[model samples]
Target: MLLLPLHSHGQFQTPLGVAQGQLPQFRAAPPNTPANEPIGGWRILPRLNVVETFSDNVRLQPEALQRSDFVTQINPGLVVTGVGTRYSVNIDYTMNNLIYANLSNFNRIRHQLNAMGTAELIKDFFFVDGRAVMTQQNATLFGAQGVNNINVTGNRQNVNIYNISPYIRYRFQDIATTELRYTRNMVSSSSNALFNSQADAYQASLNSGTAFSTVQWGFNYSHQAVHYERTNRTVEFERSIGNLRYMVTPRFGLTATGGYERNTFLSIRGSPSSPTWTVGFIWEPSQRTSIAFNAGQRFYGDTYSAVATHRTRMTVWDLNYDENITTFNQQAGMSGGFNIGNSLAQLMAAQNPSMSPEAIQQSAQALLGLGLQGSFFDPNNFFSNRLFLQKRLQASVAMNGIRNTFILRGFDMRRKAFSPEGVDSGLIGAGNAALLNNTRQTGVNALWSYRLSQLTRANIDLTYTRFAFLAVDRVDNLGLARVSLVRQLPQLLPNMIGMLEVRHNMRQSNQPGLSYHENAVVGTLSMSF
Candidate 1:
């Protein structure tokens, strides 16, 4: 399976580690640190890539004129393998640009460079495994000609960051495992490091499983303490799992599972964060068909809060079906199903405490005992539909063991936004905050792909969106597209890989005034000893 690990560098994607009733997969390629010692790894490979992009100079809209730009990127990477018994290492240095409308106008020049790696060591006995590891990432960003992009997320300025993490892990009889990790970030920007100082995160996990003649059961727990630049925030959640398995016969078996996670947010004096909940399910009918269902509630905070926690809830379902055309895994086919039940979000309204006594009282009371009834408990409902198909073929030509496969994916989503319209008015306007009625977004997407040879493959996918609301239009006619090719056969190249990839992104605004398109081409070359 292909693994794509994410860094904690500020992302909101929900993770299943705390829900599977199992240990988080503690597998990652480590970077070179503690210079003198040999940081073991599984295998080693170094890579370099270069790309150039040129946008077609076309008019965008009547109000928002058409514009075009050019960009170039250089990516260098290193991957390591075979560590303390078994482990891996990874490193990368990339140069790119940061361009946006609100920041530095259009086609802004930026340079970003990063060097990161990880190392792991482990020992086991009975049914338990003990491990220790460390990871480090250093990044530097510089703007064109030395001018920086004012946007916070822009790597366009003269900024540098170094993150260090050390962790320990233990597994009990393949049923459960836990980890103790500490992470520190050191950043130097145009301003003082006070805002760029160190922060830490604490995480705990537990999992267990029981297997009987015809049944299986499980449970899980996880909690994290996050502190950003000295602000302590508590994040805690737990998940439960239960499953039932049966064998109809020797060739086909069926298994079903149910999972749930509970999240809670405590209101601090400065800013209040809300708690949430999530539920999901998985069903495997046979070797060719599998399905999953997921529903969740999230959050959005009020003003004065640097972050908005939008409490949102929604349900989703998906199914996959595959058909083998050849006994040797030749011709094949697949179909899928998808659906979302509903969605809702909880919105917060902030009041200026410095206002007059009477004004403060009015605003405070209005936002306090606040309870608005609606279909989507939150301000919006995010829904989508999805389907896909796949096909595979064996070599029809040379004796070369080459094979090919293809896939197509389609998706659509609908969304609603209902936010407060501001407090009502009267002699002491203190209690009425109506919700938005005409705010919504919707869109569709299409994807296609092909894999050829024992080491090469390519694919292309695109999306179009439309919105019910003007500003939300782009959010509603368009998405992005990706096309890439990969080829790697170690026995033939002696630990070498050759790859080329291109991606095109296009979007049309719901308002018809805002649209964008971009193209990127990247080539890669790597070798290992």
Candidate 2:
């Protein structure tokens, strides 16, 4: 109950050994859109980073007493990317070895790896995509940041995630289209035996290729099957939805959707079948702004979903809110960031069928800007884990200028267990009771990076998080702030960069003696070839 899941969408602070998987999405491209860029062939990047750090409180203990440590870290990494006319591949591997001068027992090595690729197996009719990630994760929700591996209070766990997806699409001459998709996702944890699970999902969809001047419609059906390794529990979900839309004008449209969902776990609550309906409006004031909102009644009482987005030459903003019932594993995935970068790349490829993967990546990065890239991965939960009922709201803002980039993100999520918590039966102490409980999480994160010169840059990051265990009446607050400066040292060595950083972190809780604070300074030298 003390663990806060890591954001799985990006490379930031992702522990060593985890591979990143690509979530599959099916959508028909607008007819006649042009491809965005040309393929750039294959390239490989190799780099090394060496860091030295000094900490006043290596163990993150309470202020009454403290321990100090000087640590050194060496990281080496390699990246390979392929951008072809019909496919793309990216692979990254890195290893970090930490050495603690005063505390040799705390030394360890961490490995991280991520690989992803897409292939047009049958020209324009069939495709395959796959990804793998191996990394480490924090075992607790609070305490020190996950990056510090020296004498840390938060237990560390090894995790591996991977997935493969294949899909087929067919278009009927400017009138209609159909798609079929299948994906398999697997998760395993070395420290937590109860979390090992495998999930398989299948989907089929059909939509109008060309909207009649006043109407457009679509139908979708999807099924998911899950299996837990240790508990031997199986879960299944089947859903079907149909959508109808009528355009009253060019700028506004009305939408109506109806669906039914069946869940094996939901049957425990008396009924496994849920009938749902929603009515909403779609508004597009301009090419740069759009909004969609809907309200409906479902198995869990009143339900609503809304999304709004606006984009300018230098700024991008998005807001979203949704409510749903899912499993605990799925709820964990839902709490993280989305993979907008991949969607953007796919859209670029669709618009420019001949563009190379490298070109598509470049164009997407340019379009979304560095601050917003990869921030849009899990919007509709098409690629998450288990089943639980949850209400969530998230918002993000990104702005890029000639010399500076900034990003701000905030989210609030509340979840309740759909099933009674499982009892440990014979277990003793705190382990005897059920672990899962209703909880709420709210947090805000902000990052800013400024280019001080052609070869120098500075950055700052700040985060605040609050966790509330409603059923347990426990709450905790955590804060982190970091500032760093990086300078490219091409004059001394090609592709070399030097950095200096300072960090301060604190955590407070209602429980006595459960709080701590720490300060650290670090210097690093990195080189790429």
Candidate 3:
């Protein structure tokens, strides 16, 4: 398996300042923070990114009208964070103003907000944690750069999602633990109202720390209800799991799990209740490597899950594979499954606050690119409301040396439709019908960053993606490349840092009338106080 690890300088604070996933197979344990850290303090970071570009094919099509203009983007952001012995909080907000020098009608402004924290209601007994975010995303699986012709009318379809989750956990000494959680997520689009939907999720879980010497166990039960506002359709799901693990050795363990699931909109032979089971192992050969593998029987037929992670002084790698059934709204909660590399990078930045913003941004983007993520603008691009079975394999690698950082990644995903759509085709919005069509997506991406000097750096990004629609017997291919150089100007101002960057981007597609090439140059300056 190939491992692609995205090492970057930031972590998002989810509900309770902890990452949350619906199933145990999807979640990873959080790292332990140092006990000597500050009890409570506040830090703020402000930033900006500006760019200018001239394109011969702004619409990105073979018949596109030739155009040239200066595109200026003003991005301002603020981050406030506080950490304490028993509590933590993070609030982030950003506003992006995009202006076209010649195409004034294409101007727009975007806003993003994220807030999350955890508080111990009682000393080591009760706790509360929650996270909330509002962000904009592209509606189509492929953004404007995909094989599909770009929507130049400025009637572009964009989706805005708002989600909030809160949970409380209680522990009964070393015997057992319990949690109650709730989540509310809503989605709206610019072009079509049919894509708008709301989802409310509830979950309760209990687990034993150690029933006996070297024995651990857990149980979880969850329910989710989703409603499509425009379609007037509602879907509900119920799931339960019981698992146990016995440690044969300090570094090796055996596990067994059994579960059952039922969905209102998903029926298998006129019955929605399906029993599942799995047997797996966990192995840790050394501090540098850990591995886990599982094989199971699921509703669709067979299922498997595997994860392997290795780390060295200057390199880190992660590989994972999983098969499951899910809905479109649920995918939003699991975009790039548990990015350990990103978490480490963020920890490093938090420990050392002197790192430049440009470097941090570069590392974040590199990590994101290295994830082999499908959608350029939508993190969860492979979305569908219909019940579908999906299999995913992904690998990530990140390496850092004295003056250079490299990232590479590749992923393949296949989705099979088990149920049909509830509404007519015309009423369905872009990307809403993706599950109904058997689809496979494979992509590879790479990034390199080299430090030219203490104040200058160069970077390059290359990516290729293939989309295959098996039900329709159609395939699309797209490729992108970008090169840029940045120089920091610190002596010119106080309590502020300014940087200048020049970049060129090119994109191409295999589809006729959707293929076009263009060039762009941009300059950006940012400040922090």
For candidate 2, the lDDT comes to 0.63
**How close to the true structure is residue 471 of candidate 1, measured as C-alpha lDDT?**
29
Kindly provide the TM-score of model 1 when superposed on the true structure, using C-alpha atoms. Answer: 0.43
Candidate 2 residue-wise lDDT, 1-529, digit = tens: 0011011112221111011121111122233433311236665555677778898887777888767889887877766777778998988777867798887887888777778899998998999988887665554443343444544554555567788899999998788899999988887655443356788999999998774557999999999888877665788888899999899998999999999988777333556568988999999999879999999977766789999887765666778888877753453322134433444444445444554455455434432321111112112121112345778888877665556656677888776656544422221113422223566778887777766766666778777877676777567777777787766565886445566778777778887886888888888776654
Sort the candidates on lDDT, descending order.
2, 3, 1
lDDT of 3 at 157: 47
Give one digit per residue, the lDDT tens place, for model 1 in 1-529: 1112111111111111111111123223334423222433234334443333343322222225534544343434333323334433333332334333322344443333333445554443212222222211111100101011212222222345555666666666556555555555444333222123333434343434332333333333333232324335333333344444454544333544445434333422222223433344444455433444434433332111010111211111222222111110010000111211110001101112222232222212211111111111111121101010111111110010112111222322221222222211221122311111222323333333333543444544444433344222223344445565545535654334444556544455444444555444544444322
Candidates in order have lDDT scores of 0.30, 0.63, 0.58
* Best candidate according to lDDT: 2
The true-structure Cα RMSD of candidate 1 reads 19.4
| TM-score for each predicted model, relative to the true structure | 0.43, 0.81, 0.81
How far out, in Å, is residue 63 in model 3? 4.5
Candidate 3 stretches greater than 4 Å from native: 1-40, 63-66, 146-157, 266-272, 334-336, 340-383, 422-424, 427-436, 494-511
